[model samples]
Target: MEDQVELKRVFGDVYFRARRDQNTSIVYAHWYGSQAVETVKAGGYKFLEMIKEKPYRKLLNSNEHVIGSWDLALEWAQNEWAPQMRKAGLRYLAYVVPTTIYASMTMEMLIQRIDDEFEIRNKEADAEAWLLR
Candidate 1:
């Protein structure tokens, strides 16, 4: 499998990438970064939808997977992307990256809110294990 990681800033959302199989793409947002959290808070669903509809859509056709960084964002992602993507035969997986000690607790909280949330099988390891599968 061919993999690529790119750092991109879209509408002020600074995120990193971990792409596997070209079609299967994951956008790992920088959680502790200066602008990103604020950008998401400010942009809300509008920003997420734009990201989903444009950049994510380009990579994710039928039978592709797109992963995002935050659970709140994932909630937005599920509501915004899942139905359309599923109809097209694509799957969406949303998992949180524990960038800080605080974020690990945050992930736990978010996991409680959603049913059947995708948790990293091994929180201590890299996401590649889960993403590649």
Candidate 2:
């Protein structure tokens, strides 16, 4: 919690928080509820911006509270967001899968589409540990 930067925006449906520990930094994004494609896109852009400015090597995206499909945003995420984040020095990604079957499935779909090295788990602690290791 030493180098924590709260990246949450007032209007956005997603909550973001960026934290750094030694050489690695993590941008944590948790979906609030059902979100629109534009909302997802906006969150991605904000995430990229933060990592670029801070240069985080790890990203933790939690979809635990998501209630609807973000499948529409998957294409942009795989094609654009992932690549851009990698270019910005993102090497590890930890995704916290949603508890609901539908949301978890959708989140997994995006994970498979991404070319980056990442791990999917049900707990944020596990994700953090993986990112650190």
TM-score for each of the candidates: 0.41, 0.78
List ranges where model 1 is wrong by over 4 Å: 1-23, 33-38, 42-47, 54-99, 115-124
Which tens-of-lDDT digit does each residue in 1-133 have in candidate 1? Answer: 1243333456554344334343555433333343234334443333244344434422211111223334455454445444444444333344544545544554555445442433323233534445555
Q: What lDDT is obtained when candidate 1 is compared to the true structure? A: 0.39
**Clash pairs (backbone) in predicted model 2:** none
Which of the numbered candidates is closest to the native, going by highest TM-score? 2
**Model 1, 43: alpha-carbon shift in Å?**
7.0
